[model samples]
Target: MSLPKPVMRGLLAKRLRFHLPIAFGLAITTALVFKYTVTEPRKKAYADFYKQYDAVKEFNAMREAGVFESVRPSGE
Candidate 1:
């Protein structure tokens, strides 16, 4: 026998309620991916450059030379 009309409606409503947010979230995520695809390569290159910069001792020396103050540690 078919489900009662109310039961069928309730099931449909419950399914949509659970799935609508997931559908919207996926759509938004897809749009963001497309939008960022163009920028991602440049961002990756900049990140790689920064990683290399952070690895070099000369970068640390330059950063240290510009430091305006040093905080002395009190007795721990």
Candidate 2:
């Protein structure tokens, strides 16, 4: 059994009128929530971690930990 063409069209129009706005609203809300929850926190974490970054100290630490095969140059 199938609905008549006019009834089917009316039902489709009704669904579009109601559900389309709801779906669009939910998508926008979800995107905003994800940005706040994930993107903002990740950016803050990276900024904090790099705020005190030291290059020479890290290099020395890696060298001490046998990460390098070549000896350090006799400049220092």
Candidate 3:
């Protein structure tokens, strides 16, 4: 049985008042979980990788392999 109209009941505001907090809570929880599981580990992996990374050594290796344009090939 249908009861009343919005003029009598104010159903929209009541529904939103109840559901909005729940929706916001769920969104925040999902974001936090995703950050911990995905973003945090990705940041940690990048930090660990960069911690052991050596740029000058890589450049020297590339120079030895004649990978740079400024380093001409031996056949040329």
RMSD of each: 9.1, 3.9, 3.4
Which has the better TM-score: candidate 1, or candidate 3? 3
lDDT string for model 2 (4-49, tens) is: 6665647888889999999999999999999999999999999999
| lDDT of residue 10 for candidate 3 | 82
Q: Candidate 1 on 1-76: residue-level lDDT in tens?
A: 8965565647878999999999999999998897798678788889889876755476456556664246222332
Instruction: List the candidate 3 regions with Cα displacement exceeding 4 Å.
Output: 1-9, 71-76
lDDT of 3 by residue, 45-76 (tens): 99999999999888878877889989764566
Per-prediction TM-score: 0.40, 0.72, 0.73
Using lDDT as the yardstick, the better of models 1 and 3 is 3
Best by TM-score: 3
**lDDT for each of the candidates?**
0.73, 0.87, 0.90
Comparison by lDDT, 1 against 2, better one: 2
In model 3, what are the clashing residue pairs, if there are any? Answer: none
